[model samples]
Target: MKDRRARWYGGCAPGSRPVAAPVGARLLWRDPALWVCGGWQPEQVRTLALGSARIAVLGPCSATEHDLARALSAPELATVARTWAGSHTVVRLTERGRVEVLADVGAASPLYTVRAPDGAVWGSSSLALSSLTGGSVDTGWLAAYLRDKHSPASGLSAWAGVTPVPAGHLLTLGSEGGMTLASWWKPMRRTPHEASTALRHALGEGVRVRVSGVPASTDLAGMDSTTVTLLAAQCGPITGVTVHPAGVTTGGDMEYARALDVPGLIRSPFPLAARHLPFSATDVPLPATDEPAPSTAVWAMFADQLGTVASAGSVCHLTGDGGDNLFSSTPAHLVRLARSGHWARMFGDARDWARLRRQSPRPLLTAALRGNAYRIGRADFGRPKWLAAPVPKVSAPTGPDADMALVAELRTVARSAYAELQLADALGLALHNPYFDGAVLDAVVSAPAEQRYSARRYKPMLADTFADLLPDAHRTRAAKGLMVGDFHLGLRMNRRRVLGLADGRLAALGLVNPAPLRATVHAAALGAETVWPPLLSVLAAEAWLEAVERAPGTEWTRNAPTPAGAP
Candidate 1:
């Protein structure tokens, strides 16, 4: 059980580690015995018996042992645990003859259990439970939910038999087969008047917190001093505070702020007074070279052409010898295809297929691609007839730098196009740059072909937005770091292992096209050219399917079982 939980938290493969914490601390209680192995935080494991119950408390400092005690006495023995501190807790409760389990408000940790016909329960993940109980994971509901929500959050992991203790909820498993799941906390609802007050208060306080720690010599850049005064006056009182010289990038905001050793504040917003600065459009030229175009130039040109089409209100269709067409003629079909392997494959290709092939597929890449494509294609084209063209080309300079320039040009073009179409009626255009959402031409150019085509990668314009908000030194600095990569390194260092529980089932289900996937992997390893987006998407989808198959209560049988007495 510990090994399984560890594998899941540590990421079974290269990128699968737990998002919250290490498996040992994640699964085992930091306190005394009641040891738990394999889970992320000790609080995720709970022991409940008739007379006493022990639980690991993982979460913020605001959530404490006293809070758990109060929850245990609540009507449903459910409590909302919000750990003010960073780490989540493991909970172990031993009663005279029974015990109950509850997760934190955020479900940041992992817990799995299995129940027998006679009411004995065991397992950490549904996959583990399915193995123990000869059951299958049920993912139909999960699939439907993801199709609607774009994520598998709703307390459902990839497997069935294993159920996640929902965020802000509690779960109780008895010696019998009966189980009870209940919500302990719900979103606070307020009247319009209250909401307005809350918003104003929150904004004022947030601003104050953001500015409180700045050195007196800190310049407001182009901002007006009056706006800062007004914001300070608006905020009644300041509790936790921190100062950031420049606004932080949306991606690095949290970590950057944390690294500063500040508390209770987020990235600073542009001062209202600063809005008056004449927004200058500074075009940074891409690296120039007199050398002739290399073999890779053709693909680069094609990508640049596609960016031009995207800029000019046309959806570009990406087709490889063996991959699915990324941009379809139909918007709805395009979305579906994008959701599958189309987008990821493109991103994989753009990031350099060889590198992508060596790495397992990342769903975040898929989401990023789909998101960028939708933002660029839908915003620029909007069901225009031009999208149907077999191959669209823009008569622009075919230099290596063209791709980057095209993206910058596209940003200006897209904003205008969207304004003309009144697309703002459907989507709100914020003061911050739209390129922040991974919709920039340079990001596409620098990315592998698959990634570039899929429209996922960090956009320079978005980075510039933060640059505009930060001190000149930090603003000009390159190298946006990633927390996940660090976490992945930690997991790999732990060397956690996962059993091949679903390999055979995955093969039989035809969930993934193994031959192409293997080929792509081999190609990547050998530094050979390969189509990335399709291959990645196929691989990710297959992995997801395998996860689904291993979930609890899922049955892959072709027919219903016969009656007990039937032959």
Candidate 2:
């Protein structure tokens, strides 16, 4: 019997209520051919059903029956979806014979689509889909993955015929057939002609909503006063974590953190030994995922903090990760002016910026001339010769300076979101970054360019946005601190493991040349200053491959379906 079954999966974390359909209890969910791996339930699944509308809110969300009803009844369901916030996916069956999905900014819940017998089936896990359809490796995706950056470039996964829905968009399949994809929220292209009064309220509420019942903690190092005050107000006297690097050259957010709290959770990693690898390295336990884990250093410092947070009875870790993007402006504003052929304005702005910085204006002019939209992601990630994959060209939208800024910010949001996801999954810790909220993005995008960066003021616009919260004194202190001692220490101690990882499945796949990869790892381990993203990516990918190949009843057959739109 050919089973044309449609099954759905969704859930939330911690307080999730477990629900499972008994085998053979529901035809749509019981088709053996259509379903596989009933054993792996990392978190209990939850489902909600309402009048002719079935909704499954998965993976830590505030998605409720009321929200679903509003979505089903409202003329603008996307708007209804927007008011709700969380790191999750809302998958629902409509009153009509239709299916729709709304995922948080850039597919946070990772709802991937796969080709099943009934037509196309959507689910939360790519591995589940691969097991169902006997899918194979996506070499084209591997080729694309070989290049630098970790932006959510597309809905494409590491397999063929599998795709994820993009962020801030709604995916709907109508009763009549075919998919209707629409954007509910577009970045505010230009600062509104009128000043937006919504930025502060939106941002404050954004911080408040991500809280769990447990006390939250965020790093004070490099944290802006706006974020600190907002978090303190919403979450109520949260502890802060600041890791001081252990070395002769020490630098971190510790200085600013001291101003925030006297006894904040200050930590210094126990120096790595030769046999010890980073907490996130291949030598450590790996999380199971359908796609390759991008290169990440979150675990480099964060793995230490997870234990402390957990011990303190904290339920979640808070971060102001997107503050810099949302609050500050770069010299790019000058370039935007030049690109628009406003020669006088560009020079004037450059001169003003130079005067404030106590430097020559010539460098600003030179940089603005060199400014471009290639989004030259991780050009720092060195290319290895083993993979002959062409880089995917991104067609960035050409528009006003404000739109460009929002686009750049969103691009950053995608990258950081992925990194945070990997870190949380690996550490088994919950996390919330208010700056990643949709409302915050809206607030930042609606502000005029003048507010983001002004020569006379230190992150003047950002400081002013939360003027009520940020102290007058703190507003003038815009200096940022950088830390790299941990990276050097972590890499130096893990060279052996790094070399061992390169010798295994990855080298056999020939996706990367082992020599350069090993050499890069070796040089970086010795603190020779080589590009790290590609090396870290290689480490994570190989570890993932090893885990996949070791699965009990599955083999990663090389010649799989080629995903459409892959490099």
Candidate 3:
């Protein structure tokens, strides 16, 4: 009987191999498919048991397996993730066969579960869950997916009826077969110095583990990667790469990458293929599920860069992906001030934010009064008016309106980061991010909101936090490099692909109307606002649906992996 359950864990997807038994989430087979979402990776599974209860820490974790087990066994359930310092997920099994799963606040490791009459099926892979149950596409989810072309604000996956264990929540499966979810990480406000101290410790430690005391290199895009490269060098000198924009895109990344002169600073040709006109899937990753990778064009370049890093004989690479979302928020922090009745600070912060962004304070104050209407894309697709998304369900944050705006932005960032994780796994390389580190996240949220956003002191924070790590010359070189120029080329080349979205699966599902979307593409071809991001996401979804249909087999029988793996 024990062996039978173990077999179930290994073959959740056909052709998947198990790396020994994992405790807790018994239904979650440690297969390759589930590793992509977050936390668990194919080679990073570790398990420990005590008496009857058992625990598994999957992905990058600082605690030794035994120490992690001891922490989970504490009377306070939150202790399980409280002491951990890296991106990971934890699952604990009780004597009664009940299970508990916990993911970090970033939801860096996504956990998707489906309940059946026999038992519950859970894993990190959304596509695997869909295949296991023969699930149909959920139109509401499809609506939301198109709505969130860039990043996902909610924990839900695209597969209908398959539930995502929300980030920072304790998800438990009772022995009798029921489940309960509740928040575990409680963030408290902190003094600026206190927050800085915590970050210094957390960020330094985060980079160290990924480096494993070996020399490392990081992508130098801006302050985020720049700070990380500097921190990694404290332990030992590390190299950096600048994915300089090739083609018509303006500004060079090398000026920034070269300034932080540590050791081997190489200029990699990460051209944002301005040639793939309309929308290039040329060597781009396909979405196997509803993972919203909004910036596909940029990602193609990132994918090429990762391959270069791997070939350079580096074991791990550091990233500052979550930096902006975690550190540099916006005036939205004022919403918390107003909500809490700190009227004086609210007014002051708004005034300061307006000055930094070079806008009038009146607009900032008015926006705070009305609350943030977080708009990622145009409200609806270019419409026959009938092409509409379901009214968005706003999950009012526990604090203030700005929280909604900031959280929404972070969700998109997380989705992009997760997509990059897939690229890393494909290249057999490890990527470390201090911004998403559990400790760094808790510390950032605890800082006074004014310092983070209201004053727009991102550059100052970057300088102050890692002052020792950064080079003196690079301190003042703060201009950002953007790929706005690449978009113009992408829009022209992918005109047909954009047209396909209007006439494709989305139109058939009533998720979009063909006529207006078709016109939008024509207008884009004629050099209007180029292409809309929502339209690009729809094309990404169409590609995924087509890939799913193209698969010759499901979970029951092995399907040949597509270009981006099983859908």
Candidate 4:
């Protein structure tokens, strides 16, 4: 079977100006003002040239050539993206002689662009774009990353001058080379039943689009994965991979996975033992991704499962990533409710939430009133003690008032998943995350706020949407499995290597205070009260810097001849 995946880059130049193909990429198609190239087999790319317009939909696109031409007739990025059934990046030269690029809504296959002298150049890989622009890591962005690894710096890349085309937004270049962003996706308000129906349709279509008569695999542990796994089984044969803590007879995900007695389901259980712990192998080099992959920090834990999936001849692995972010609620919702004078609902939710956490409702309401969306605790308002310099202030993305916090969080999570996709690519497996699909998120968020979130019911909307397919016990289970013990054990074992990071690149760049960082690592190894996010963020940053420094030089761009009558 031909591989239906690709890594691509291209540029749209002014009339008759030439754009050179990047190194290691074969030119797929080229015209007078635009060029497309990729590292892919012929089956991976889809192209169409219609009246007064040309478009290239790269990476596993399911849209037919006729569909592309029809969408091109309208010449709107969002419309074109909507016409396409599968997740892919779109590069279109509009009839107005402007360039428009639409990245997938979930950013599962995001595109990055850099403004060139002639026009804007774009590629699937940020690192490649950085190399093309001769750019270095953006330390200011790094500062923001360290400050809030959970929330990515919106529209900013780790590499300077390389910007991610924000998810669901259209990147357009004017004739004279000016760039602009226009949002092409928005959640529509719908009744609870309408939203649920839309969600079910979107979810089912999302699964079917990826199932191409191939052996498929999925994580069958979490609520999201369980829902996805059972759905995939309905379409075709799929192996549901579940992990259970070795030597522990019960508890965690196995029980939930075992409950599903569906046909075409192959139960592939993997034992999570000491070998899969983080830092299990210190000598092995981590895969270099386009950005600092914090997921790589714990990649060892998933390697065995990936190997198992690979052995099963599964080409596409669907994960339930982005589901929790899509389905869960935050304190922001409470504040929104209070401002709207839904006082009774707010208090009820606060009381219910407080009961679950075994805390008083007063604190939750107080935190909401105070505009603290993260938590109601000893709020650390200033810079962290571990950082050596002041970080840049990152403003929240400006958007719809409803669930903007959750949207921001989901974008950040999707960016993280995008980084993890890089690692999966290195392993020669395509990671498909349907929950991150734009249509699915739109369907979920379109439901009334009350339907989307509830204190007494965990992911009430998600549970209700798939109630028939999922068991009540699996859907309503509030307890989540934590691998903190495994991580801490890794910390204990890799104490020296982690401590050495203090004297590493970040310390050299004055981004970290070695002494405090070392102290944090030491305390974490000893199972003391220590914050791991900052430590792990620093480690990821240091590892990225190390990888970037050691990576062999590559020229992603080369000079090509300008066309006749050009400047």
Residue 520 of candidate 1: its Cα lDDT?
A: 41
Q: Is candidate 2 or candidate 4 better by TM-score?
A: 4
Residues 34-129 of candidate 1: C-alpha lDDT, one tens digit per residue: 232321223332322223444444321233456656554444444333212221333434443234455433232335554433333432334434
lDDT top scorer: 4
Residues 1-567 of candidate 3: C-alpha lDDT, one tens digit per residue: 001010112212222332222232333322222222223333356666676666666766767756766765776556756756677777766555556777677666666777643456566655556665566776776776666544343545677777777767887766454678888876776798988887787777777666655646787777778787766666676767766545534455665564555553444445544533336655644434335344453445555666667777765678778887666566676555666788998788777766766767876666566555343111334323425656344332433445445544564466445655654655556666667766777777666655565364455665677777777655555447554455656666766665666787777887877787777667766667644566566666776677556543223323313222212
| Alpha-carbon local distance difference test for all models | 0.29, 0.53, 0.59, 0.71
| Candidate 3 local Cα displacement, residue 258, angstroms | 1.2
Per-candidate clashes, comma-separated: 93, 5, 11, 0
* Higher-scoring candidate on lDDT, 2 or 4: 4
Look at candidate 1 and tell me the lDDT of residue 153: 30
Q: What root-mean-square deviation over C-alphas does model 3 reach?
A: 6.8
lDDT of 2 by residue, 1-567 (tens): 212111224211111112221132111221111122232122213345556565554444444567666666666657776655445566666566466677665344455666444345555566545654666666556655666434333445666676655557777765333566777677553453333455555555555544535466665555363365345445565666655544422333544444443232333233333233352353344445565544344444455566556557655566666666656545567767877798997888778877766778876676567664323111334455544455454323333344454555455445435445444544545555666666556656666667666666676666665565555546667567543554566767766756788777756765676776777777777778755566666676777676567653323222222222211
Candidate 3 yields a Cα-based lDDT of 0.59
**TM-score against native, each model:** 0.34, 0.75, 0.81, 0.90
What lDDT is reached at residue 137 by model 1? Answer: 38
TM-score for model 1? 0.34
**Residue 201 Cα positional deviation in candidate 4, in Å, after optimal superposition:** 1.9
Local lDDT at 135 for model 3: 64
